[model samples]
Target chain A: MGNAFKEESTELAKKTAPADLMIVAKGLTKKYDDFTAVDGIDFQVKRGESFGLLGPNGAGKSTTMKMIGATSLRTGGELTILGKDPNKQGPEIRAHLGVVPQTDNHDNDLKAWENLYIYGRYFGLGRKFLKKKVEELLDFAQLQDKRDVKVDQLSGGMKRRLTIARGLVNEPEILMLDEPTTGLDPQARHILWDRLFRLKEEGVTLVITTHYMDEAEQLCDRLIVMDKGKIMAEGAPADLIKKYSSKEVLEVRFGSSKNAEAAEKLKHLGDRIETLPDRILFYAEDGEKVLKQIHKLGFEPATSLVRRSSLEDVFLRLTGRTLVE
Target chain B: MSLINASIDSAIAIAERRSGKFGAEFYAGRTNAILERAFLAFKTSSWMIVLSGFVEPVFYLLSFGFGLGALIGGVTDGAGNSVSYAAYIAPALLATSAMNGAIYDSTWNVFFKMHFGKLYQTMLATSLGTLDVALGEIGWALLRGLAYAMGFMVIMAPLGLIPSWWGILAIPGAVLVAFGFASIGMGITSYLKNFQQMNWVNFFMLPMFLFSGTFYPLSIYPDWLRMIIEALPLWQAIQLERDLTLGTVGWSTLAHVAYFAVMIVGGLYFTTKRLSALFLR
Candidate 1:
């Protein structure tokens, strides 16, 4: 009977086999008591792809990452990782996946190197392998100088870098990072991006969740923009911007007093105008032409500039709210 | 038949490699990994914290041995033989010390690792499962209990409190008692919502320490009250230590072992069940 069942599963695997698909989820949902965190959503991630889940704080990006990380069980969905069902084979699937959670969960009392060493031990790696790996990881994280420092004593960015380095102790097939640079300074963010970019160049599959649109654009090969537990759009950053927003955005600011009134006067100047408290944005294929046309309409802005569109513009257009919370 | 055997052998090999199938060595290796982490942490901590376990019980030994022993000359044993008050309370103190050491290690240490340290979260991210975590933590608690029990035994032997060479057997007995309490204590610690609710730990522990035949014989209490005390698992630990130190091995020893065996099983069940609920959900 077991052999027959195994044969049936192998048949199913052959049928559903994607192009080196690393993760696949369909109708994925997570409900907590009466509240649903991740509503039914569908997506696939190919091998070696850097995939991003972009959303605000409660938009279920983290929830989806947890499912793909094989840590949290999905409430309702068909989710598979490396061709193993996440529900039945969590430990098996997790063997090849490395997860850096949103919060750094380092063993605070241990030294940075010790943290990496112990985490490697959990994968049942040999001591001889770990010694060389720890040195390499410390150098990779640029934490060689701080290897002896206790984890809690490191700066926020150093802690994050160490956490990322610790995740690589297993030399995993895929690395999942949730908000990898959320609390970092600009310099720290750039350093981490460099580190992550290097990891990608090594052909490690990445699954990242981020509210920072630029981080999404910088790290993700393709992304899904989520709002209220549902995916609003999914595409490459540039493709998403082109599909949802225009080529450029014209930002025109009036005095705070006339900002609301200025938006009304500027309504017909572009394809769409979104008015904020202090500025009005004109979404148009040619932002310079829109600015010129606004001047012809006897509407002079205190200051104005034309800039190319971004993923942020696309998110704002779809969600009717800002991405960062 | 050879073809079938070859296919079956290949299938088992695939299953073992793919599943990271845990044998005895797998569990021992992973749990030792966790203890190795503890060892790393201990290297950085002050020696005072490590010594504090031995110090507290020794203080109780001196204060009670001299103060209360002077006040009450001697007391009757469980089998109705008169023994010095110092000797009477010494064996029971080992039990209570074991309880205290295991309780603190399992509850406070485990909770801190769970919520504050996020250590278990990081461990779970690896190939380790809920059972690995439970056993690993219990294993650490046993190490701590062993150290404290051995330290107390060192003090007890020098004071002429041991009535028999069989009293030497109490070292392992104290560790067994510690294992029971540590497992059960970890089970309760898993349910705690926050640190402030830790008063409940003290609440459960203080009464058990006092009433579990630790300070006095159960015969002094009414039969109904004695029955209730007997139901508590700590009382069995005290009985085991008391019998072992006095060299009075009897059939009831198995009953004491059974009490703790039930606790070990039950506590491990709850520890894994509750932790899986908290973490894997």
Candidate 2:
């Protein structure tokens, strides 16, 4: 199935030489009165790739998403979705793109199936085609039994799944999701991730925006880290981690009063060290070796932990702040 | 099922073709699809609300048209002809019913959908444009206005309030009033921010209904006051319906029709502009 989907994409790609580039933006900017929400940024998304925008709240991730979604016009710069200008050809561009917004906006008055069915009708799909498509999407979202239920009766995860299904009713070429898993429980988040991963495998291009570093690492093939409406770094998760962070990290807590004093003593042991209110962080090639060196220097910590470097460390190194507050 | 599919398919093809000719940014020509969604939602809507809209004008007809008209014998219409007090007010009530139905859907229902339901946000995210959304919603409200007008006429015909067969034309006249009110009401709703602001719609509507020559002819008032009431949209609607049902069609009837024509065009223009400003910006 994956090969078949890829082959279809290749056939489509032959129609235009640079057609594989699904989205392109240059010096993109958005402004609301005096506030510049999205300061000039540049990025490109290719066909069949999972691209992401990673940032903290109010970092202009959603603002950028809205511009690409063609609902919000950019205040400056150029954007082309599927080789069509969003400002002039929004309906044409939107017809071929699927959007799953941050918050679920399903019609509470409509039943689960009707939500999907009515959405397809908005795309000018015939009732017969939608009748069959709605069933297929219900099965895919794993909400077959809940088809007749009102939207309010469904659980949070169920509603999210249904929203995702409704976005697919038009069989769009690119699917854009804004904060897809922000409010879900751990298990629910995992299930939603699995579903998204399957779409990626089936060769559907995905554009996602998220504040969660773990989610960005799990889902994005390549991502741009944004801070205060600017791109801090852009790369694959592991490459970003390797370039901006050490191989491992050692975390030690010595109560609030003693942490600052301990960080002063352990500064020379690791490649770098940071002191917080109640803990200290040691960036090193090997965490265990760093711990042993700390002990040899006659520093006994109250509590200690060692872990591998992740995208969080990369974000910290780039922006001098964490991805999530 | 296949036959339904075929017809829908042709309808979509027509809309797409129209969109291509007109440019695809502001209008996709898919207003009918929006109307279809409303019908689907209406299947589950509470019937009491709809029945109540139809019942309000009937009660007014009973109390003011019958009960009060018995005390007051005859009233002078615009044509210098004396009409029964009940017959004079019956056409005005029909005009008021159309306005009420249109206002209810476009203001309260549209306000909820805009702020609470986030419905227009969802629709605009699709291939649908702001014009399509505006037209579809106003079209639905106009349909309800049509329903209310027809229901009131059914009650009026049995009571001998409709004296001439020309009264059938009043149904279309009521629809025009609805189109005018519904379009402008939806546009005004986009500017409102809260339920408190929305109450002002009702506040303004009550005075217009009472003073628009509904209970009596405008000549009873002083000249300046009569001019103010005549300038209102409901008064023009009442004038049009009165001319038709009273068999008094003349040059002034054309003037009344022209007033609503301006309303329909101006309202649709304002509605489309406001919807785009609010959602597509």
Candidate 3:
């Protein structure tokens, strides 16, 4: 025990290393009345790592994010963000964390610039510093021309960018994004991803929750697959796929669910199979090999496509469903 | 533990224990943001401010004091003194005006911001807390009430409705009463889910304004109703203002002031707590 204690103390002394863990949650839970929004779940995020909670709409991703952001209280267990308890040290913890909620919620009463300035002031930033930062953030968000425009007039994408910029005004060490690209167009999503990549390059720890498997594949270094308020699997994107899924996926689409059942009859050719409303998926070590076996089975799917197994396949293997709505 | 580890552990413990401050500061900052936004709204819609603050009060003074006072003649108050109906009702109007302004700002403005505007949710992301938001909103309500009171007092002074320099004290008194109502109204707004229940607030306020000795004296009511009227904070404020304006100041005036002071403090405490719970979550 003394040797273990000595080792732990030695590890604790090296905490100044920039990549130390920034968030720690141990059996954190959130209950609203009798319904459990977030069941007791544990996770840790290291500094500079882009972590994701990948799940469907009702999988409690947002609830968990809210707990870490200090916007919502935990019903049981413990959570610490930036080495501070969210319940007691919320302000101090929040001071070092930026959060972009699922909705816009921008100040419609103030000009876009004023909204940034006022929010900066709330974080105890000086007026002079905020003025300069506001200008820079406006330019960063590409809203320099719309600084004087009311938030009510800005487009959804512009509002989202402004919200992101507002979160960054305090120069937070950890940024929590709750479905950052949920309602954005493809162009807007790409723009937002580019900006997020920049933040990651700056060594900012990011915690994002999204149901988009493509987004998880593109952005997350490590992710947790959640379903029904529980973590189904967790690891680096590639690692999780290697662990729970095959190397490739073969998609076979037919006329309807009944036709998809006929395709499922050929499931023995692959490691696993998934049947959807309008399509069927075969998970196997090699997609081309699986397709050859399907051809030999005399099952002619309306359309068949071979692709690399992704986080989507991992989600399906774990939850028996697709991530998309 | 080593000294450095001990210090770091202490810091973490302190940070954890002090988390509530973030919620508090975020709310306070939200309130300040709302005040700033209200000022911006005032700048853009200057006409609304003028109409609500100046024109409306002046219109009430002229129509009631000059128009309605003529037919009603002088009436006796609870003090057993005869005064012009305008004089009796002017102070009451002043009290009610403050109540109206504060309640309007706190309820309608706060409800809209809480629900439709989603302003508090935006502010919560920052360091501002719920109490900060409540206080900042009440502060603005008080400011609007003060402005209206100043305009009302100016009109009252010129018409000789105010009998003594002591009447000027009613301005701050009006603001205090306004703040009490505003803070309590904010507390009430937290529980209200939609605009439908707001009509209930109007239903309660309209009767309170009319029957709280604003247009007449409470003494005209039977003993039981009169007792209930006296128990109300607005009635106490109106009585205090009327006595001060009429130069009939007495020990009962202190009790009236105490009533509003208690209301201000108590209302603010609960409002801040409720708002913190509502927005912080």
True contacts kept of 3: 0.38
Q: Residue B237's C-alpha lDDT in candidate 1?
A: 89
Give TM-score, chain B, model 1: 0.89
DockQ of each: 0.37, 0.42, 0.30
iRMSD for every model: 9.2, 9.0, 9.8
Q: What tens-digit string does per-residue lDDT give for candidate 3 at A48-98?
A: 899999999899999998888888889998777655566754566677778
- Per-model TM values vs. the true structure: 0.94, 0.94, 0.91
True contacts kept of each: 0.50, 0.52, 0.38
Q: Which residue pairs show collisions in model 2? A: none
lDDT of 3 at A315: 88
Best by lDDT: 2
**Model 1 C-alpha lDDT per residue in residues A145-249, reported as the tens digit of each score:** 999998889999999999999888777778999999988999999999999998888888999999998899999999999999999999999999989999999
Could you tell which candidate, 2 or 3, scores higher by TM-score?
A: 2
**Which 10-residue span in candidate 2 chain A carries the lowest summed lDDT?**
A8-17
lDDT of each: 0.83, 0.86, 0.80
> Would you list the clashing residue pairs of candidate 1?
none
Q: Encode model 3's per-residue lDDT on B123-187: one tens digit a residue.
A: 66666666767788889888878988888888888778887688989898888889889989999
Ranking by DockQ: 2, 1, 3
Per-residue lDDT, model 1, residue B120, is 79
